[model samples]
Target chain A: MDLSDVRRHHLSVVLEHLVCSGPRSRAAIAQETGLTKATVSTLITDLLDRGLVQELDTPTAGRVGRPATDVGAAGHSVGALGLEIDVDEVAACVVDLTGTVRTVHRHTAGNRDVTARTVIHRLRDATQRAMADAAHMGIDCIGATLALPGLVDPNEPTLFVAPNLHWFDADLRSLATQLRLPEHFPITMDNEANLGALAELRHGAGQQFDSFVFVSAAGGLGAGIVLDGRLLRGAHGFAGELGHVVVDPSGKPCACGARGCLETLLHSDVNPDELARHLADALRTVVHLIDPEAVVLGGSLAAFGDEFALAVADHLHADTLGARWHPCAVRRSTLGADAALVGAATAALDRIISDPTIVPTRALAH
Target chain B: MDLSDVRRHHLSVVLEHLVCSGPRSRAAIAQETGLTKATVSTLITDLLDRGLVQELDTPTAGRVGRPATDVGAAGHSVGALGLEIDVDEVAACVVDLTGTVRTVHRHTAGNRDVTARTVIHRLRDATQRAMADAAHMGIDCIGATLALPGLVDPNEPTLFVAPNLHWFDADLRSLATQLRLPEHFPITMDNEANLGALAELRHGAGQQFDSFVFVSAAGGLGAGIVLDGRLLRGAHGFAGELGHVVVDPSGKPCACGARGCLETLLHSDVNPDELARHLADALRTVVHLIDPEAVVLGGSLAAFGDEFALAVADHLHADTLGARWHPCAVRRSTLGADAALVGAATAALDRIISDPTIVPTRALAH
Candidate 1:
């Protein structure tokens, strides 16, 4: 790593430590990061100067040396606006550095039938309200994220396709332009499933796992592929597409013109035991491919709850050729419907913390 | 990243630049890595001292300032032993720092119904022969990777399940112990599909793509999921079990007991067009999920050649929503059936060059 990269990585590490572990002295950070005390002090001081960390006036007791002054993440003034454009709802919220949800506004309506212009305007209203709400809370919103239910170009904030929303090639970034956020306050546009997986990993069932599949079954079956604590957004950023996987080559046709897709099999009329068995069967392919630590079913699928868990268990265990298919744990999403909003917020906050330059207003003004 | 981690990262980067981009002077490296000339010099000196790099005699002109000494990866003396235990054959080879495949020995035979002990013995023979061949070439074998046909526990280098070999939870480290190469000469055991994908990505069809699916179809269909240039080995090192993906919920039963799995469908009796259609169906799922740049068909499936490509292309292009399903270029694996062997070799070579400590026999002795 270069000198600048070293500084950046250290800054991120120190900030993460503070946010996750609460206040800690420089010595504690050094021990945790395996950096020298001098280096840790330098990084922490740099962060403090950047307003990313705060010195706790109250001294901490536990230490190898003198009672050391504690420092914690101080990016309290900066929050992120997270917006999700789903088939069933248009959700917006503000998330702080500690990942606490501050203000949440949800517009529950069928997103499928809405015109692109109307939805964008509605989203604009929600975003403005979210920003206004954050301002009311005295938190300066820096970065924002618009999580959509479709394939997105990570490099471009353009919605390539939203089968559920019936929006294709819609320039989602136009909303950012309308919002008039500064260029440096980067806005990320991505699949809601990806962010939902990230949120679950950070604050929900996946906290214990570095690798797991987060399946968000709503209007469609979307998967958030997390390997090694990192969400897998393939080369084109269209990953975790569980809904389109052909489960039955001869079954019903799909929106993508495919037959026997997993999406077609998942419906309200489907039997719970049969749905669980089918879901488990589909999941087995994922399990066989990426033997994950666990499969956390999120979104509307979370409604399946314990019954779904039991059915998945039965099918997964059925694969046991004595020990070849030792079933991994199956669980429901703890965040339920809020996974996407929380994840979008977390992703934006992470970007701001990792590179404060992106949080333009605060960095330049400070 | 701490001081040591920083040093390690720079060392790997420098060595990679040398091996991949050919030799470069310290000034060029500094420019490329955005490191100070002094830092590059220190890192280069450390590598030279460790005998992982050597100062090149010919200094080139395009460099700024003085024609600084050009250094390149000097681990040609150390090599990696790569072994592939497949359902159809046992393959082993020695790969050097420049990724040159030196000695290859393939024991072609049906791998089904073999005892783990017997297969291990055969692999040991091939591994010993490959190492002996490398020794004859005056190169020292430093690290080894054994690629198998099932789920692997990365932490233990043990086989979790090899449905094709009927090996379940078999302690594969026994091969390492039985071969008894060296204490510090690290050994990696992983699924063949993962290795095959890595091989294809490194040396064959996938170099152009940061993400792609490598389908190794022999007796069964296995996918190696690569996303954003990193291979996805789910939590248990068992990501990419495409063969077990339920293709038909009520089709033929598989070894894993699931009906209509991709594995059960890949039999010789299935027409080539039908097989391609089935494979295309599976590839569509991956495409919708990750939107990879290309899908490279490897292993026995490559034998189908243009016929397979035509079928996949036909099906993929059939989804002509014009935007939702943009058919990514699909082609046969350039490495064909040799992909797994090459991948195993490349993976091992990568390990040795990245960390010379694993080259205990050469690094320590020298």
Candidate 2:
């Protein structure tokens, strides 16, 4: 403790209560959080002025004197900008405090045909347009996150490599600067799969499974592992590289120069049964290693329907070591193609949701 | 939180400071933890009364005025018991607060030839003797943990399944009663691989790499995964079943009714070159999924010397997708065969280290 730490802690407690328990009276928040009523009222006032929370019209009408007004997280006052640069398309979206996507912009482009710089500029332009829309709607953009289809530098705004994107060691900071984001607005970059996993955790399959492995296969095969309600971005942020795992040692060479990797089996002419077998084989390894509760298939694979998921699940069940006792479910992604963009936006908003004190109050707002 | 929560939090901070930073003066601890000198003095007094910490004779000789006494974690005053039930033997040991093994007893026997009840009794006898040893040394055993070579019920003292031990749904609570441990002396059960990973984390390879996978092949092939300095026990505590992961899908049938598991390639007559290839294949999948920083070979497999490890490492490096950027090392276990036992004891002691307030004061001690 410092004074600011205590203030932020109290503010977060009140904000999280409304976010998790729906609207609640200030007195109820005090009782639930074990804070004094006076303290709760002061914290609620701070949150209300910051545009992070709003007073609801509903009152404690049942057998109560001078009805207490309910408070809740503000819906449209603030939002986060999420940008994605995929292999074939550029997308941008703004997500509000309640995890609702308010605006979306998608542009199909020959991303691989153009230089990495050109794709970056295109994504930047999309982000600029999204910001304009957010400002026009009076949605205070608290932060922004760019979802890239590659290995992101855990320490810097850089992309280590995106084999499918034909890019290596790309600078993301320059792009952030080009967007001319508000100073100290906290723009960052993350891997697409990781962000997609975050999106699923906040808005989709997360309701059913707290721990899962999100597998996406639109432009490339990748995985995002969530365990105990948090994303598992391993020792160098390269934890879920499911595509490169060698499924067949004597099989065809992959784009990453590996022989018989999981990606090699996803050829257009490949049979579903063969792909299912290979996918099950690789997923079995993942289940054995991390032991997630469910396997959520996203990207183009979710469109394969229930039968495909069943086949993969069948193989997984047959060979899983403790399948009889430890059951693992396999299902399709609820968000489908929108998972990555939504996840990117969710990641941006989480910066504020996790620390409400970071938001400037109305008096300080420019 | 309540008053007790605040008290425990402060106590934990003071105890952890001594454990992690060595001996420190009261003023130094208060400065480090940001607690007032009066509060630190009260917490330290409480810890002293509970036999968790001791004041050292060393004084601030170079400082002005009266010399300030140093306080540090008490090594011999308190300890935890660790019991192990392996395929061929029963082992028990006591580990003091400093993580040093004080007493160890290993009884080698043909455990497979006996009934589950008979083996349980045998382990009970070993635990009884270890408790006597601990008592003779005037060490208060705060807790006890049993390590088994199978799935441990995370919520109970039950052993879900120990395939090699020929045990299923073993009633560990009954065994706990038979040992007649002190009242409120917490006793728990955990998987051998999980404990081994914990041991490696606190005392062995954990010093070098915060995250690594401990692969052991003595009784059977098992892996204990540690990521970001914590064990990655998947949903249902069934993670790290490396032995059962299918390696040669078209090869021989495994004992688990699965065809071509990693364990099948580890037969006595199997060629090292072929075995290394299969192990590497399975490990490549593990690497892609969890991305641990190192792979630690333990038990019988570690005795294969540097050549076998190097062969496996070479194959793993050659095929791992992000090998060029994210490097993973392969090494032998530092604690060797004793990892599980030490880890079990450490896990037992962690119960107190994490919450020192739980330990009754000396005046309330039995």
Candidate 3:
């Protein structure tokens, strides 16, 4: 392999280590990565030159050697613009490389009843506000990520089905054209629940554990599955469609054409107790399928808090079930409505830091 | 890093390519891996010396250079031992490195009625017979992997529970002592469904897709979650316990003590029609959550064939179910009862071939 490619790989490994572990000395990175001290030093210097790392001036004593200076990630300068098109509103935010949602711009609108043109324009308005805010704050935009509540095809930039939004086969690339986005910026579209899980794992109720199920209940039910620190998006990128699960064989027919689908039950004009019962039954399905550490309830269920948890635990114990004892905790979503926006920003920043070549083309700061 | 460690990593890369993508020339491998031609040559020579690869007389017609000789994997020389402990039987088999089951030996017993000691004896007897068969057939024994229909923590060598087998926290390491296995021949204990999914992904219905859910139903429903190719066991190793999901709030209480659970519905003394309806309802939960390409039915349901497919399809379509046309095909288990055993063999062989240092310590062939 060429020296440059090798160097890039080493730099990636060192940068990933620093990002995941907070900060470390060059000698510590070398020891952890099994790389030589000289190689790690060269990589650290390169990262500094690229505006990806900064000297922390924190001295750390080595077990067998002299102390070394520590370096940390430089996350303040570069930022990611994350936008979301929800049924209730269009939201936008700028998140720095440090995984902080620095600014938020939200506009309330009944997006489902509006035309696709109206929705796109509203999203454009939010993006403009977010972009201007980032510009004023001197945070350079790395890239943009749009989150939607739908089954997005991983192979294409298309939202295949957002039943709640009543938008089918929505082409995001053309929509970006409608928004008049810059040519250098690339857009990535994904399911909203997936982004919520990323945000929760990074900075929400799921921060304590490496794996959990992020259940977003708004106009419909969706689950973002994270296991072993990775999101489990199926082959078709339609993995976590938890709302469509059958709650009753004889219940109401859902838009999915299934009798007794969980979403139809959740949306029924029922009392709070009845609503919690329906939601819990749906959650029981998730717990049985994937016994995660916690089920982080977001969207509509976030406000219920203890009412929701007690109801779900009343029927099926979140922690333990059966003779085998499969235990899981139930908690409210930490980020709530902002999870998707924050997660999109995290993803964009992640892409830029991991693959620096894209940074120059996408990030205005670089 | 030392030259040898670097070579091992490159060797792993080259061998992984060969194993996954079939045979390729040194020049082709160098090009594909971004390794130098000289480095590829050195790694190839090392693998050949280790009996992991062999050169063939088949020559490739190059577009510009002289024809190069072809090489392929040496699989027959090394074999893995797979064993299984289920409610109905204790089984064992030997599989070659190329993913072929050379021998199968199984003993039928009412495992659920028997004590843990009795089941362990039956498993030992089965392993002995299978090991003898492998020896007689000139197949080398690569360490054994034991599959149990229960929850197994990765950090512990124990079976947490096998409800059908009436087992709770069965100690595998102590049981290995009773089986009299050699010290270096490490025994790995995992959930039967996880192993079944691995077998299916490699040789069964799941070979076509990188992601799908393998549902193992016998005494209970268990899910083997394969996402982006890796099996997802949650942080606590208690994932994929699908039978525990509540189906009918008014239904009978399960061993997990939840009323109207999926397992309770499945186990009701019902006709094939009723059984299929229950199974379909349960399958619907999996499809809604994971959205796999296909749901490969295994365990007791494998024998039902179209009866199971028709019944499940009666209420819920296997694929294309709703306003969201999620078309996932339905297929029966290819290996049936042989899945867990075969998958265990695959795991054992995979471990040995991928990490050569473990080969000599465990596998008799090395």
What TM-score would each prediction reach against the true structure? 0.89, 0.92, 0.89
lDDT of each: 0.76, 0.83, 0.76
Angstrom error at residue A226, model 1: 1.7
Report how far off residue A339 is in candidate 1 (Å).
1.9
Per-residue accuracy of model 1 over B1-366 as CA lDDT, tens digit each: 356777777778777777666777888888997778898888777776666678878746685766667787774576778898888788899877766688899997777888888877777778888888988888877678888888786677678778778777787655677775666567888778889998887778888887788989866678887877678776657677777666667787877776777778876478888887777766666676666778888877778778778788788767523324445878789887778887887787787456654443224334
In model 2, where do residues sit more than 4 Å from their true spots? A2-7, A17-43, A58-70, A363-366, B1-4, B20-42, B57-70, B363-366
Alpha-carbon RMSD of each model: 3.9, 3.3, 4.1
Instruction: Give the winner by lDDT.
Output: 2
Highest DockQ model number? 2
C-alpha-based local distance difference test score of model 1: 0.76
lDDT of 3 by residue, A13-99 (tens): 787677656788888898899999988887787777767777887745555656667887776567888988988899889987667
How close to the true structure is residue B180 of candidate 1, measured as C-alpha lDDT?
Answer: 53
Worst 10 residues of 2 chain B by lDDT: B1-10
Top candidate by TM-score? 2
Which residue pairs in candidate 3 have backbone atoms (N, alpha carbon, C) closer than 3 angstroms, thus clashing?
A: A319-A327, A319-A328, A322-B256, B319-B328, B320-B326, B320-B327
Report the Cα lDDT for residue A361, model 3: 27
Each model's iRMS: 3.1, 1.6, 2.9
CA lDDT, candidate 2, residue A203? 78
Across residues A1-366, which tens digit of lDDT does each residue of candidate 2 receive? 545666787788778767645788998998999998989999988998899989989945787477888888888699899989898899989988877788998988878856877887788778888989999999988888888888886568878888788888777776666766766668888889988888888778765687999998868889989998788888878789899876776788887766778887886467778788889888887887778899999988888898999999998888776777777899888998999999988888877767997888887554
